[model samples]
Target: MEPVTTHSNHDEPAAASPIWPWVVIETLTSPDETTVVLDGASPRAFSRLNRTSVARASATAARMLGPLVAECASMSKPRDKYFPLRDDQLRRMMTIPVLGPSGHVHAVAVWVGGVEEPLPRTPIIGAIEWSVKGLAVANPAAQYLFRAPQGDLLTGHTIPEMLAAFDIWPDRPGFLSLFNLENLDVAADQWSGTATLHYDNPTDTHELFIAARAVGTGPNRVVRAVVTDITGTQNPGHADLTLVAVRAMPITPGHAVALADLKTGFIHEWLTSSPSSPLAAWRHHNPEFDDNSKLDVVQTCFALATGVRDTATHEVRVRFDPADDWIPLLAKWTLIGGGDRPQALIDVTPLAPISAPMVTGCRMCQDMANRNNAPHQ
Candidate 1:
């Protein structure tokens, strides 16, 4: 039997800090049900017993491995198991089923403690291996972040699939581009950025700081990512507006218009003084523009940003004064790029009142009026 080698010297006092080693072993089980240790720097003291028997070396492994192996077989993916040792020590074991080119598990890789230390859930960390087959390996933390389905793992699923399933759409322009795996290479060592994600359930939002680094080489290289929820650290109780559309001033200023500019434009274009104060006003000024309408706009904007749609047109009813009848306006929205900032452009044109009859000869005007009258579902 090979001697178990570790940095901790046996001559050192047992009272000295103990260095725990995690070992990997072959999957073959003996008739006695003992596992053969392939390699690891195990404690020399523990080696006094059967050094090659992983079950004899660590009581935690002896207990956890049997059940974990069964889970991997049934689920077709590895699951993590954690157990505690004496002296407030925690041990985490992650089993990886190594699949051969034929899509069969040829061997198993058991990664034990010493890597994932200081077991705190906050600022979660995970490891992933990317390849042509999508995520070849995703740690349990990564599975939780992507909201993997119960009894199923994140392995074999693409990033976009997980993002859509969890309703974790990127909140800013060009944010989704970062996940384009084709752009990543061995030369690309690290990535760090802040991403805001909008959740559909109960309409919640989270701001996350993500940092990742490449730890291995080739197409199947391992990348470790750490995500920290920084929502509370930012301005409290306010959603950051991701400006999708910006209207430029018509004159020489040529700068994007602000909210005040919108107010001024309303007065100049509609020939009426603003009725409601700027603070009390909302966009479109239509009673039908409720939470659902807002959500539709958000989804449409995301779709446009992600290349799902090219252009979307709608008819909006607006009124400067509450007492006055609403004015029908045509709004056309399209994605605009090739500038420092990503933005969309909207063209709004005033139309005849809905009560008025459309021109008999004009097909476009008839269709526009018909759409304007159609009640939104």
Candidate 2:
């Protein structure tokens, strides 16, 4: 916690200057939220450095640090405020509220010009810096959780790599929602949720509760994430229901491909909120679309085939690259005549390769299910 850089007020315009006076007002609120105890301020001797009132300089801290506290509390977000000095030099101030895990406002950090560095790290907490490129930094606790070396910095490590031993439960999109910044507006409104990852090996799964806040501004912004492994605390009711669907739809090789007449050799449906279909191919290929989209494609193709034929069957080989491994699917479409609006029934199943391990369901989730179903003494 170094003091914010100060500038000379000698006819120099502070508006264009990058450095100015700043203070971090720390407080501890009572349980009922009626009283606020000013714990202390970072960058000691704040009042003396700024030449403010002596009464403002309490033994613990300089109370409030001028009007920045009141103004910041009123707005309830980080914003810049411009102040015109006697010499007509405009000073810009930005207030950022620091919130605890429970969404309690612990402190208000006021910067005179710009933020020079990221927020102070809580060494004991599992924290990481993430961007679209991948993980940028992993603190001590985060390193331990992700199995990275204690002193090693996380550079270019993707989330999949960090959790390589786990299968992201309910697919990647559900897990990624925890890190989404769509709801991030203020410090307290940071994106946070629990994501379950079933360990691939013969071990228990993990439920990671993550709180991610967008730090910095514009293109330079990165996510500041705090992670907690809540595996032991999560309710069993939170079990991924997608696993049950996967178990129900077993994969089998197709007998023949008859509906090749349909364009793309796959079904296409415009469904968006459909439950994820049991598609084993996506986990390995990392397709651009989720299981739901893949299922929609399968359904849409069936619809097209039913329009022409009474019964049709299609075998779809999905692969982005010819050299890459592909997923085969068998879709059967049956047109039931005498219906009000061309009613049809469709069945979709993965085509398993000869002498290959079952690929119909998530291996990790299926393994856990088997163990849970085993009879106890």
Candidate 3:
């Protein structure tokens, strides 16, 4: 790969700079938990860019380039996923790489964020880019989009060399990326935007958000876009904003399947740590909650369980009683397992629509339900 652009700082790269500095080794000495990858900040933050730096590279440098080793030692194996560094201060970091023909790292990129923030799969493309790898989409129905003046879409399943296939749309029907594009051209190398699209009905769609950054100054610059989902709100124009109390009884033998094995662990964890929990910290900045908040959470889960529906076909539903008018959308999703293991996906769909409020009492009823549901994080 040709250099994207020459840099003034010969070794260390600026945070937003397209320049990537990585150690391309025939192999790492020991690619294990003790792999001594990048540690905390140091006065000598960077090593020399000499040809033999691979033999003398730092753990941080080795980790920044997460390529399969060319030669594994007796105890080592090929990496199935990214590495986890040992740094108490840093919550998480991921090293994504572009591999060459020999399956060695040609370029490297890194992302660091807090534990609460989900890891981003945003593409990192540079002018000196490699072939675009097909995205590992969590949901098969997810719409992959490419930005252009007329709003272009990249066809799914097939990996395109570079991003040449960014605008092949309508060729695949039913499979679509719904977005209301306000900006046609993204001027910055790094930028993010949200698009609101209607699904099922014009009034029922949710927002699709993307944050992307380009890595190269040249034409081959790879563009990485990270996508995430946010729960949608009711459109005040189409539907009347009214309260509804969904039937709070558990699913019968006829309509729904049993709740996913009540996470005995969550219960166990809760039981063992009741008195020890920081009640003040939990209620801080919120006067609405008191010492009984934890107990209220247990009650709320029981009530929400009424809305939890699992079909005979292994479909799942977690419904809010007074939700906005949204058509039942059945889709398959692969949720994260304990770690890399992929959990079995459920065919999720709503058992029934909230047609109307079963019973609408005074403000007292609404307040109670809100408090009951409040303990749910």
Candidate 4:
């Protein structure tokens, strides 16, 4: 990608537009977290060899070169001036060298001033050449694990810790390094803007998808990692988007599901508590409403012959009969008076079946039969 140029004037406010164009060179560190910034003049002026060019160079030198001299005087700064090209200076950035499939140096990425950049080949030819020549005899152990073309290391957790959580480990020592991280399946390079990394552990499959241009950077060149869990199922009424409802339904015959419709405020309170119930789940899922408002409804389902109670206050009690196969499912809907809206929203459906007698003998039935000539109640 062509380096972006920003123009700024020295005489005007630092924020003002520039009269002369400048290219900001960023070097990224190995972890891709830290960065170093360098300011360069126009390509035309850098190509010229004159006193004015040298003076302009000196003024800019104080910003970057002073630190370099204090740190290491023997270091050779890049002669290109358009971009830094010194060997020792480049190595100090501590970027991992990326190799192509053919075992050739593909790119050198450095972390500088919190930005990651792949240096231009023309300026860093010497460093690339040197790294290639040494590759033939590089450490085999190091080569095996740190060979990933791209991707950052999983931070804040060690490989051992991850393995311990699953009670397993790779058979080889080199399998745990950052270089061995699987290449993100998504094409992030083509993205024109910031990228996001997504981790999915669906069915315990450790995989990642790189979504390009999913996030944007700030003025400081800080890249944010955006992660989404693709494996988890989202419940329509639950917060934390659970895959399975904490409440269970019986699979036996003659059993039915029952739901409760509670006020919205109480539902919100439940969801905020630890081990939130279905009502809490509903509130967690819908956060747009104020908790102080009356609850439109709270719904819950019960299996016939099961006893359930509110774990929080123990004030609500519900019981189901074994003979009841159909239970009501509850839903709450807001009603605005004198409006075209519905005054209430209620949906009751049979969730299961009942095995009890299908018919009953009633006095009304006998009276109807005798209505022609006999007495009726």
- Listed per model in order, the count of residue pairs whose N, CA or C atoms clash below 3 Å is 0, 4, 13, 33
Ranking by TM-score: 2, 1, 3, 4
Candidate 2, after superposition: displacement of residue 205 in Å? Answer: 6.2
TM-score per candidate: 0.29, 0.32, 0.21, 0.18
Winner by lDDT: 2
Once fitted onto the true fold, the runs of candidate 3 whose alpha carbons sit more than 4 angstroms away are 1-141, 144-153, 156-187, 233-377
**1-377 per-residue lDDT for model 1 (tens digits):** 01222223222222224333333322222112223223242212112123534445456555566656555534548667655444444456666553432233322445545335642222333334444222334666545554555644555544333333322223322232222333221134545455555544645765554444443444555443433345555542333233222221341211112221110011101111222212112221212333444455556555554567767777656553344465565656665542322345555555653332232333333444566457999
List the candidate 4 regions with Cα displacement exceeding 4 Å: 1-88, 91-204, 207-225, 228-248, 251-377
**After aligning candidate 3 to the native by TM-score, how far in Å is the CA of 210 from where it should be?**
0.5
Candidate 3 per-residue C-alpha lDDT over 106-207 given as tens digits, one digit per residue, 9 for 90 to 100: 233344444445655434221111112222221111332222113212222222111222212111111111110112112234333443444455555554
lDDT-wise, the better of 2 and 4 is 2
Worst lDDT run of 10 residues, candidate 2, spans 266-275
- Tens-digit per-residue lDDT, 15-134, candidate 2: 454333334443223111111211122122112323422113221112324444554544556655444333544444555655443343444555543334333432123556655333
Ten-residue stretch with the least lDDT total in model 4: 125-134
Expressed as tens digits, the lDDT of each residue in 1-377 for candidate 4 is: 11222223221121222122222222112222212121232111111111222224323322332233222212222211222222112111222333323243322322221123334332221111111001112222222222212232222222221222221122211111111111211212111111112223424332111111111222222111111122222211212111013123222222212222121111111111222112211211112222222122222211110123221111121112233232233232222111111112112222333112211232322333334335556
Off by over 4 Å in 1: 1-124, 132-136, 165-188, 196-200, 215-218, 235-377
TM-score of 2: 0.32
Instruction: Please give the ranking of all candidate structures by lDDT, highest first, separated by commas.
Output: 2, 1, 3, 4
